[model samples]
Target: MAVIKAEAYGHGMLRVAESLAPRVDALAVSCLDEAAALREAGHHQPILALQGFKDERDLRAASQLDVAVTVHEDSQLRLLAATRLHRPVRVWLKLDTGMGRLGFAPSRAAELVAALTSDPNVTAVPGLMTHLACADAPERPENAAQLARFEAATRHLPGERSLANSAAILALPDAHADWVRPGIMLYGGSPLADQSAAGLGLRPVMTLSTRLIAIHALAPGEAVGYGATWRSERPTRVGVAAIGYADGYPRHAPNGTPVLVRGQRVPLIGRVSMDMITLDLTDLETVQVGDVVTLWGEGLPVDEVAAAARTISYDLLCRVHDRVQVVTG
Candidate 1:
């Protein structure tokens, strides 16, 4: 399943779903609303709501939409066991192997599986699934441990099983049970902290570019941007680019974070403001107003920018606001 939750990690969910419909066997979303949006947009592929329904109303809507749901907790299970829908709803029994977030206890897997398989409202035997907490860190024991627990719990279960996430898809082949959930990888972000996307042979699918609107020649003592956080150490040419936190550029990005100007890397020299950022263009003498500046993507990796900002690539990608115009190629 191609996990395109959170608007495909802010890369535009509907478009991504449209593009992946012919390629993937199924799609996964965080909730019913996302699945409903895809259905309304005319997509007929299978969609799994990862968070499942909150109440009977949501369960009824899921049934109406023919959306599969994750039965992770007792409340959802209770609701599913008691409600009688017009049609059976496909269910995936999520086991809490080690993720600690969602899922029922692994020890109850046998009881739940038996109950779900016999339940009149359930479409078929419930598919067993689990979330891995440390798939990105291959050296961590949690991945193997989770896989072991999952296998021990559902080794003889009838329905299909799903365990691998984006990180596991790249790192743990053993965890790729029956369905592999690819989220960040589908958007071209590296799931491993120690690896780069390019190194992992994953090219960025989105590029965020802005234009340099103004330039300034600053003297040694002149300070730049809000709070005067950065000052010129010598003769400096500062290029002001038209993007900032309001547009989803990290405000916490410190001086020296790289920005691409004319495809050349230059250090961001001051505090990232609400509307713009200042870049040190002292070496790029030919840079001028209206020159293209890449915030992150293509020549500049979002991971690098995210690292300098002390966050993850996921945060940077999802935080991109509506103000930023999206141009798909």
Candidate 2:
């Protein structure tokens, strides 16, 4: 089962999910509303609510829709216990396993499982699951440590288990249980610093692009952008792109970070403002307005872009603004 949570990591949940529907056994989402939207869109795939029910009404609705709830908290368990649904609710028990986020403690996991299983309203306990904390850094011993802890917590449980997220699915063979939840890899982002999804045969799913709105010829002393952060050392041609921080483009991209224009690499020249970024296009002639400028994807890797921006590809990919039309190819 693959979880299309958070708008499929900000890469159009519906499009991503629909593309993967044939291969995925089921879909997992963050809440009931997302599940309902998918259902309305003619997606009949089993939807697992990762956060579980928000209230009694949500529990009833989930029961009616056959959405499985991830029992992550005691309050949710209680809510499930109190709901008078016509059918039993299926659930996945979450084990904390050192993430310190959701899920019950290792020692307490069995008890919670027993509690949920014993309830008449609960129909089935399909699996035990945990999120990897450091699977991206394969050399880090913490991955093994977390796996050991998870194993210990789930050893006596009879149901199937899910411990491999995208990183674990690619790197940790032992961590691959009955099911795998891959996120970043599906969008062509590298989960490991040393490896890219392309090396593992995955394609990038989103390509952020815009047009070059203007070109400027500048003298040596001429500056570009709001802060005048970059000045030409010699005669230069600057290309202004119709994208900026407002469109979730990273504002922290320092001067000289690469931006692709007409298959040529142009270094950014100045501060990225709310609506624009200036790039040094001096050597590249034949530039004009309406030329395609890719922010990241294809020739430019999002990971490299994020590195230049001093952030992660996940943030950059997910933060794209509403003004930018998202087209899935």
Candidate 3:
């Protein structure tokens, strides 16, 4: 089962999960609130809480809600050990392979599993899990190195193991284990370097779009946007989009970044502002007010947009401005 954590990487969790429910065995989230929200919305699919509980109350709520918790540390284990619940909790043990973010050390996973499984409150002890650091870069040896370490650490463990994330599922064939947790891939983001989800026949679940608020014609030497960083070298037709850094459009996107206006690629002009961006639509013949512009979707590849913003597609997808109304298609 693959989990769609953090609103399916900010692509609207409930809607994304609902669409994926038929294809995925289960869904995973970051907290109790998210799990509860999904349950209330009538999602019967199993939901795994990756962060686990912070206190007894949370643990009790999780037990009542029947959410699976990823046991990442001994402290969380201690809390679980102390708590008396109405029902036993299912747990997926997270192992810290090389990602320094979370999970138990590989050397101590067996001990932790022993402690967790012995507890009567613990229902399921699905053994061993680790996150890949560079599965997207197939040329990088880190993927194999991490997989080797994880396999070596769990070789003696007598239970199921999971190591494949989105990148692993696509790039490293050997990393696939008991269950593959593909997050971004389900939402149509490519974990590979040369291919996109679209190229792989996956549908894009989210399409970020905005309207043209204004249109202006700039002659040679006319400046555009904040910092006046972009000056027209020739007569240019500039269109302003009702999206900016505040709405999660990257501020670092330089001049000449491509934005799709009526399926035409227009070069961005000047600095990205708080609520708008200026695009040079010089060659686009029929752009007007309220023209739909796609910052990154369908007509424009997200990886290309991310490259223009000097960031990664993950950050762009995750940081979409909260103000933008999400429409499920």
The TM-scores of all predictions, comma-separated, are: 0.98, 0.95, 0.94
Q: What's the CA RMSD for each of the models?
A: 0.9, 1.5, 1.7
Residue range 1-329, candidate 3, lDDT tens digits:
76777777878787777788888888889898899998899988788888888788879988999998888877888888788899998888888888888888888867877888889889856657888887888778888788888887778777787889888888788988878888777767788877867786666666788999999899999999878999999998889999998998999999988899988888888999999999998898787999899998776777778878787788888888668897755
Is 1 or 2 the stronger prediction by lDDT? 1
Sort by TM-score, top down from the best? 1, 2, 3
Residues 1-329 of candidate 1: C-alpha lDDT, one tens digit per residue: 99999999989999999899999999999999998999999999899999999999989989999999999888887898888898999999999999999999989999999988888889878888999999989779988899889888887778899998988999888988789999988877899979999999998998999999999899998999999999988999989999999999999999999999999999998899999999999999598999999988898889899999999999999999998998988
Clashing pairs in 2: none
Q: Write the per-residue lDDT of candidate 2 for residues 227-326, one digit (tens) a residue.
A: 8888889999988999999998988889988899987888988999999999888888688888999888888888888888888889998888778886
TM-score of 3: 0.94
Model 2 C-alpha RMSD vs. true structure (Å) is: 1.5
For model 1 the TM-score comes to: 0.98
Per the 3 Å backbone cut-off, how many clashing residue pairs does candidate 2 have?
0
- Candidate 2 residue 151 Cα shift, in angstroms, is 1.3
Error of 2 at 75 (Å): 1.2
**lDDT of candidate model 3 versus the reference:** 0.84
Between prediction 1 and prediction 3, the one with superior TM-score is: 1
